[model samples]
Target: MTRQAISSYKQELLDTARTLRQQIRAGEFTSTTSGLASGLMQGNIVILTADWAQDFLHFCQLNPVSCPLIAMSRPGEPLLPELGKDIDIRSDVPEYNLFVDGELTQTRTDIADLWNDQMVTFVLGCSFSFEEALQRAGLAIRNIDLGRNVSMYDSSLATTPSSRFHGNTVVTMRPFSPADAIRAIQVTTRLPKAHGAPVHIGRPDLIGIDDLATPQYGDSVPVHDDEIPVFWACGVTPQVAIRNAKPPICITHVPGKMLVTDKLNDELAIL
Candidate 1:
């Protein structure tokens, strides 16, 4: 493809996010929206029956680090206009992991078939939003540099339980020199919506991570002896929570794949 053609694909992905709420509302685009829209906000998706929404909401409130709530759809309402002018919770996300009795059975590009009047969609901010800031600052993201996804590990830290939802906080890891690690922390701190600061630096043992080479989710990036491994709270924590919640049924994005949005990453900054 020509550079213009590649740029066109990127533009289509970015432009679609602006009207993603509309496309999703109309059932046009539904696939993992990762790396498509650069500065716009992307999120982890979760959906559960209305009967379970309360408990899930409580779970998020109880464990904000692993479950920061960005926006949630009212029961049966597919539209999340507050998140975007025309977002449809039913089909906006590119892919959805379907869990039956706490076990993921299948994956779909859209969840319109599973839509119900009593279903609620929860959108949680993702760390990918801050990758832009880190890159702009001259720090190389190992996953991005390697054209792969960031590595995620299920930590030993148990999240505070709420009713039926409880599990460990899954974390994403990146390697950098102590100096670059500090810079990454500073850059990511500005985007709390995208996972904020490092929860642990240098010592994986402190967080119950016995092995850094094997991740529970996503591909592992190499860590040079001179570089320290930095860990951040990940949106994938919800998957673990979902498995533990055992909600008759639940849905979420596959690890690494994320829902791209029109909201800018800078828009999430407090400063």
Candidate 2:
């Protein structure tokens, strides 16, 4: 594995997120937010018109594991004061994916031009929040060590529908030795908002994943021979849900490139 040296920072979670957001807003940080601004909450962004908000909200409620809704913005409001002091949804995220009629149309660094009074933004909890927890527990995350985006795949497991939204669950995978996998589950279980625990372990075939080497999203890292592949419910499940919903216009964070929020990771822990 090619390990990258991550710089050590003394700033607190809110300070870190604040500084990171500046870079993101300036179009300087366009890559995945994984392992960045550690201990702060990271969210998957999903924006849709008010007309489609209710069904999508219901879809999130139906699939809590994959779509743990955090803070949502009022229609036409771009600032999410509840999640951060002044989080501007239009430019807080490093990257955004615009989908039209179930097809991805373009990727944007900022969505200020697309913002409208009819649009509502949804912030879903992300697994990246627990990576810090795992590291605190002394487990090394392969994706962070390798400086690659976490591997994600479209699973065969179907999500419950809400009017127009319905699709398969998407899962993020991390390879670990059996012992570490067990510890990872325990470490992550405390962070319910961060996708909680492993949804599947050991057998990829059971989840209809034909090849671990070819993930549907993000870069694939090597899973060693002695390690088992561990899957966790991912925030990106909404993207699949959005594709099936087929709204005239939908916006989402490019998978892995998330919005760093000021909320602390420990604040999301149930225990």
Candidate 3:
């Protein structure tokens, strides 16, 4: 519910990277990336060896909804200059989940020690970007308001497969009144990079989710009597691909925790 107790770095361009990297390097700021860096575009990270990047890249292209490619780094290069002036893929992110052979093995703050010449980092658009837009329009996101991670569920909807990468789609759920939900849809539709619009709304059953209270990942937010559940294609869907690919080594940001980019959400908005 609270950000790490570490002191935030001074507010400056260089300071931004310094602070962000420091927190990540220090094992602080390991929680979700939601509501942090208010105007920044947050990304879902997927790092794999170059040998596996081609297949994963193809998978993302085939399943754009769950894997909107934002920026990709060359093999072994940890710097993501496209996202920020001095971004370090190995340390800027708050937390990372390491997967070996499609199974989650470890979670850590930085991947510096694990970095290799064959590693390629993929930055995928995340739902957090549109969340700022929705809040700016005065819509209350239950997860943010409740100070809990957004609820994520693995759905029965299948994503287009690429070679070894294949799996069901994962979605993040938010509850909104019918009217607010309509506005949210309109507001979020502007940011295609941020999942665009709701894939499903008002019916959890349609997505094969049997219970609203039990999510496959992240925290569950309460749904009020009049509110309906609205679902957005989540960047977390890649985890399923990670499991399916069973790559020798893969690294990804933990659920909720994401890479904060310098790009503004408004810049990505489609008029």
Model 1 weakest lDDT span, ten residues long: 25-34
Question: Compared with the true structure, what per-residue lDDT tens digits does model 2 show for residues 1-271?
Answer: 2233222332455677998999999999899999999988999999999999998999999988899999888999999998888699999899999999989999999999999999999999999999999999999999999999999999998889899999899999999999999999999888888999999999999998999999999999999999999999999998998888799999999999999998888889987
**Candidate lDDT (C-alpha), each:** 0.82, 0.92, 0.88
Pairs of residues clashing in candidate 3 = none
Worst 10-residue lDDT window, candidate 2: 1-10
Ranking the candidates on TM-score from highest down gives 2, 3, 1
Off by over 4 Å in 2: 1-11
Candidate 1 ranges beyond 4 A from true positions = 1-34
Which predicted model would earn the best lDDT? 2
Model 3 TM-score is: 0.93
- Cα lDDT tens digits, model 1, 1-271, are 9999967765675576767545544557653344556677888988899999988899888877777788998888887767665566666666678999899999876787888888898999898888888888999888887777788998888889988888888999999999999999999887777888988888898889989889988887899989999999999998887887788889898888776676777778768
**TM-score quality measure for candidate 1:** 0.88
List TM-score per model, in order: 0.88, 0.95, 0.93
Off by over 4 Å in 3: 1-18
